[model samples]
Target: MTDEPLADLALSRSSLDRVALERRRSEVLSELLEDPRTRVAEIRGDRMQVVDPGDRAAPTAPGAPSAAKASGQDASRACSAGALGLVLRAPQPEDRERLVLHLGRDGDGTAYVGVVSPGPHEDPAQPGWLTLRQAGEALTRRDAGLFTTGLALANWHATHRFCPRCGAPTEPTEGGWVRRCEREGSDHYPRTDPAVIMSVVDPDDRLLLGRGAHWPEGRFSVLAGFVEPGESFEAAVAREVAEEVGITIDAARYLGNQPWPFPSSVMIGFAATTRQTELTVDPVEMAEARWVTRGEYRDLLREGTVRTPSGISIAKRIIEHWLGDTVESVTGGTSPRW
Candidate 1:
């Protein structure tokens, strides 16, 4: 059978094809870098700049219009989502950015990558760094795709600078996609941990949301956990729910997934059904667990007591899907799906 309906999760849409063969050729990557048509998305720390376009939607108060509806700008902005504050015009090689990678080509066949470079921003002013979480929904499909891929590559480069097998530092290779150890002659590719986040529903259709021990007060969303070695995505869903909330999931179905590149992980979303409604929250895993009906979920949102995940997250999408309506997000923005 076909997979369950997918949700409109952020960082899910991409316009690049990641020309793998071209990236393999150092000469080709270098040539592309020098091409005047090529563009770069600059990443500093975890933030990228959203290209500010005239007539673009102005940044609104966090709780103003739904962040989802914040679209409807110039066609150029939509086509070049990468232009969000983070994208840079064509730069000469002298920029000498520390980290760079070949992302892929856009619909117009213009190649784009990410880099650490200078921009129009005057030292953290109006056009400053936008966190990926904050910018994902606001970005064009191309921009979101480029940012997520670039961030994941950049984060890997930052952390995997050392060879694990030998006590030696590795160097970036393969267009910033692989790390090779001089001592061991080993190649390490970027790592993406597979995580499962699920919306668990009981017979009454109440959605299961839990607050992690460290999450802010009243914050709750669906349960999520990393996939263990040798565990399938479906199995991980069942195991995580049981481990976190002591509920036995009777059936699990695949939904969709999004790349959560906060540090490199793909969140596989699922909708699950569980017979056991009783929650025995694991002190080590979560602070509290509750099954909230649609009415109660709306009431909690109305009372400003419950906070859900951001509009861009898969958790928020699944939760909204199950709630059968767009519950006012605590983040004060409309979800991208609506």
Candidate 2:
């Protein structure tokens, strides 16, 4: 729980275990989206059907909760009016799997989900109330990001009700995969943005950290920026390092990626080494940059002295790698409060 990104919250399903949208739209529509112990209703707008406290399982059964599908007046509409925007998170592995949800249509007919998974790594309960009376506010950002995938799919149906190129409205086809444009001229589908974040490790195995001027006092995290077109990920990493820290990165290696949905950003993690050079910081990108020692970092984690990224992120991973064994015993193994 070292304020770094903890990406493995939900199991990372491989293609073998994945259920694709185009191929299994029927399975999704027919099967309950949530566990059988919970309730399922149409998730339009940004609301979710909350399970009554009495309906929730006791503390013993941590993962046995089910979502029973509803069929009443409350059945047709999304519960609690949706909160986060639906995101199309598709992992194109050796085999590809995509998840879609219904989102509301913009006035211009564009579909949007309010938030994405790999975003700021904020707390689920951190935002504003959905309904005016605050009667049904139960979705966590973690779950909201998950449920929004479905909501975005829904909104895709309403607005994509046409084709952009031919001015022909599209209809749901292949369960919910392709929206066949009215004229069969050209059908348009949903789109996702690609962004990269890196966790650079120097020759000494110390993580390279930088703090944007706007971040919290004493809080520092990894260097990250969007990947521009026409450049490779390695190039982006080098360019970003140069722009932010004025240093050249040596070897750039891929680690993993997390879905960040503050409007859909994929956090690409990496490990890289930098050549010895004078430290320089870009005022726009970072205020300070340094290679913190393990001993120095241990104090931050144990005493909770330094402001760091929330424990649920990549920055924490880099630091954990930085602190190694010392962090293992911090906080009496209570998941290390980041």
Candidate 3:
């Protein structure tokens, strides 16, 4: 593939400056929350509210200044029409009781924080509330980074409420970046599991695709699996291909990586070449496996015989890399949701 494909991976684009040293300041979260200049993104479940960039009052609290006003920019000129931005507001008094994360700072030194609610949004059916999968492709680089980081941290806090060493409850500290054990005094940080997703190719330049054991019939994407203990990404790639499809790859090349926080994982991508062309599918892991040439895959997509992966996924980009054109170019429609 080329650098353009790797650069276009949706979840990999982030412009926030994660001032790590600032996260260490005592009472920093409190200070930022008190400042009206700080920008706060509210997350409920996996969704955050989105607004058209051209809308001036929609993204702010009832009485507070909008993000553009706080940052000294003209809201009308902030972005083109039809583009989306996060609904950031001035922090509320109740935010102190919720899980607040210090996302990062913009280039202008304006702080950004995320406050997560305990349950789903009050009105999920409301027009603007959307999850990362639905909004990531449309959001600005900074908002995308904020949403991705905030959701990943919130997921970690949700599942790691107790200390692994002594079974004690943990409390958030260090701007919600670390959790300290109430009993043992041990500190825990956020966790991200690493998985490898790869496009496997045979000598004939045919791309390998598979449907998961539980996936519906028409949906298919590249094979992916978690990296095991004491294994490199390349080794994981080879093992995943061998275990899932019974093919040994001769070589593997790194393409790129992106955060996939469906639960919690960072997906590393690779392209592998193999000489074997045989049929052996692991029934427990895959429902079906097949090799498709560039022409055949295009026909499958154009005919609506196969569904592509989610638009925000690296799997889609990897498949696009192997196919040498986008699925939309062949199908004349947006990528289908899986």
| Pick by TM-score: 2 or 3, better one | 3
- Poorest lDDT segment (10 consecutive residues) of candidate 1: 66-75
| Per-residue lDDT of candidate 2, residues 295-335 (tens digit) | 66766666765655533345555556556652436644323
Q: What is the Å distance of residue 115 in model 1 from its true position? A: 0.8
Error of 3 at 59 (Å): 5.4
Q: Which stretches of model 1 miss by more than 4 angstroms? A: 1-4, 55-86, 117-126, 328-338
Quote each prediction's TM-score. Answer: 0.85, 0.57, 0.92
Give the worst 10-residue stretch by lDDT in candidate 2.
9-18
**Would you list the C-alpha lDDT of every candidate in the order shown?**
0.74, 0.48, 0.83
Higher-ranked by lDDT: 1 or 2:
1
RMSD of each: 6.6, 12.1, 4.7
Off by over 4 Å in 3: 1-5, 59-82, 120-123
User: lDDT per residue, candidate 3, 221-338, as tens digits?
Assistant: 9999999999999999999999999999999899989998887899999999999999699999999999999999998888888989866789988999988887777876554556
Candidate 2 segments exceeding 4 Å error: 1-185, 325-329, 332-338
